[model samples]
Target: MLDIMAIISDGIGGGLKSVLNIAIIVFPLMIIMEIAKDLNILDKISDFCKPLTKWMGVSKESAFPLTIGLVFGLAYGAGIIIQSAKEGNLDKRSLILVSIFLVCCHAVIEDTLIFVAVGANGFFLLTIRLLTALVLTILISKKLPSLDKEK
Candidate 1:
């Protein structure tokens, strides 16, 4: 069975390059994120984001994790959230809601660079992505249903 699987995989020749590229790109990014965490840069960024998060009905403590999620990807951001959750800083409902929003994902530099490299109106894509994130956040908060049931 394994031999058959390998043979099938071999049929997709050019597709194999994408797998290698994905691994190369992701591993370095993960390492960089770890370094940023160790350096307390993430903490500083979270502190900066607190006020905005507070205004949006999330705890100030949520700022950093959400920032990580936005600047990295859903996995990295959720790693932060999971830590916070383990420490009892975030409740179940808030984490769940935040995950929904954060899964939309962002990359601080790479995404824009890709657009510029490809000549796809980089600024336009960036503007739309940013606005969409902000608008969706506000809209979701407004549309949020009460998770708590009154006795």
Candidate 2:
């Protein structure tokens, strides 16, 4: 009984520790993102992404969250994506394109750095991921119906 109690306690402690670690990362990221948004830095990033997004056949609305997800990771980008969708900023086709792109290649910088720490070639990995995401997003975006057609 004592052993069982200790095991249960350890499990609970581990779970709480994991949650705390996640909150530590996520909260700071969110705060920084909020500040960037307010400072219009996010708009600049979105503007920089416009040509890439145009090549992918998505709108400028999708570019902002897509750029954020590409740089910061899904947890950071998801909030903006949800807000944009709720506000009807992105059309269905653009949302679909952005979702697929993010799924394939979100967290570019962090994930590449992590893999590099484990002896992977960060440049090669980043290139492959970016290329795969771009090609797939472009192809899928072409296959999907246009927003105007939906309405």
Candidate 3:
């Protein structure tokens, strides 16, 4: 009976504990995203990607998604592509190429640092990941037909 009561209590309001938990998770994320937006950090990220995207055989417009992958990793970076794809910003050909790149790997900065901390062979892993992704991107481009017929 006591356990049931406590579970019910937690399910209902849970008072300050719930509020504190929400604040702890949300506040920092909101603040960081706000600062990032104001600082035009995404723009800087895109700028750094311009040359790489071209070399990848994708368009200049592709810099945005690739840069996102470089900083944030596959999920968030691929989310960008999906969102943009839905909004019709990206053609299917480029989307596939970017998707292939991200699917093989995205080098998250903090994760790489953690890899280094464990005394792993950092550059070896990084090199293999990048090479695999590059190869997959090209293979997908060669074999698959473009989905975006609009532009």
Candidate 4:
């Protein structure tokens, strides 16, 4: 028979561990994002990414969130994308493009690190993810207008 006290202890321990892990990752990332914003470095980075975004039919405004999703992860980047959408910065086409890309390959850095720790080929995985997302986003961008008309 299972011990009730032991199960309770394990549950609480798991919850605390999860909370700590999230805090460790999120707090430092938030600080870095804030510093980048304060120095206008994010704008510069987004400017450099404009050509790639344009190729995927994504807006310049969406580049910031896309870059964030690429580096940090979807959870952190999503807030920026949602706020921009609410502010009328991203049209349906741009939103669709960004969604396709991020869904395929968000959290490149963190995911690579985690995979590498487990002996996976992080660089190879990262490259594959990026290429796949790029190709798929390009295809989606090309097809989106026709799809929209059908809807």
Candidate 5:
């Protein structure tokens, strides 16, 4: 009985710790994103990413969220993506493309470092992920019917 109670307690404690850690990271990122939006930093980022987004057939508004997802992982990026969608910055097609791309390649730096620590080839891993994401997003974007046409 005592052992079971300890196990339950440990599980709950670990879950709370994980949640707290994520909250710590996500909250600050959300605030910084808001400040960046107010400063028009997002516009510059979108402009810089214009070529890539254009190639992906997504709106420029997707650039920031896609960049965030690739660098910081999806959990952190989802906040920005959701906010952009709510603001009407991303249409359905853009959202779908960004989600597809990030699903394949999110957290490139962190994941690559972790794999490298485990004796994996970091360059190969990063390259394959990036290439797969890019190709897949481009192909899927071409297939998807434009939401604008439905409206």
Candidate 6:
């Protein structure tokens, strides 16, 4: 029937619109991230995260990816994390800790802003996410066996 065909068409069109909307946001964010990396802005942000990395007992190499994940989200940060791992900058323990922390609180700024737009309390949401990530990372770090022995 014509109604069935119309429904199918509408579904496909709606799906494409959703994908396009996400691409619009993601593409610009990725470009900006590349620009920041080239300009060494990412290094400065990583430096700022050193204390947090130390508190979590992960290596200094994890700071950059951790910062990226917090600011940009895991989808973007995963590239940096993978590169660092391939370069031997991150050990197993560091990778696990970074993954744990990021999983808990990736994309704080973007997520908070989106929620705030929908009438959610941004500060409270940000605080809870950050705290949860910190506490969970630290606790998990303590539980993971030392990588030194794996060698």
RMSD of 1: 6.2
Per-residue CA lDDT of candidate 5, range 1-151, in tens? 9999999999999889766765665677667767876898756765676777898999877888987787668997788889998998989999989998998888776677656654689889999998889999999999998987799
Best by TM-score: 6
Arrange candidates, best lDDT first: 6, 2, 5, 4, 3, 1
TM-score of each: 0.65, 0.71, 0.64, 0.70, 0.69, 0.74
Tens digits of per-residue lDDT, candidate 2, 20-138, equal 76566566766876788689896788788899888998877788898889877897678878889899998778887898889999988667765665568988999999999999989
Ranking by TM-score: 6, 2, 4, 5, 1, 3
Which candidate has the highest lDDT of all? Answer: 6
Ranked by lDDT, the better of candidates 2 and 6 is 6
- Residue-wise C-alpha lDDT for candidate 1, range 1-94, written one tens digit per residue: 9998888888776467655655565677678878987898877877876765755566666787888887776777889899999998986656
lDDT of each: 0.71, 0.82, 0.73, 0.80, 0.82, 0.86
Residue pairs in clash, model 5: none
RMSD of each: 6.2, 5.4, 7.6, 4.8, 6.4, 4.2
TM-score of 5: 0.69
Model 3 agreement with the true structure over 14-131: per-residue lDDT tens digits: 6666566556645665577668768989799789877667656676777888878866678888888989889888777888788778777784554554565456677887877777
Give the distance in Å from residue 95's predicted Cα in candidate 4 to where it truly belongs.
0.6
Residue pairs in collision within model 2? none
lDDT of 4 by residue, 2-107 (tens): 7998899999998897667666766776688678768988678777778889889776788888887876688867887888889989777787789779988897
Error of 4 at 65 (Å): 1.3
lDDT of 6 by residue, 65-149 (tens): 9999988889877888899999999988999899989988898766776666556898999999899889999998998999867
lDDT of 4: 0.80
Q: Candidate 3, TM-score vs. the true structure?
A: 0.64
Q: Which ten residues in a row have the lowest lDDT in candidate 6?
A: 110-119
lDDT measured at residue 150 in model 3 versus the true structure, 0 to 100: 46
Residue 91 lDDT in model 5? 94
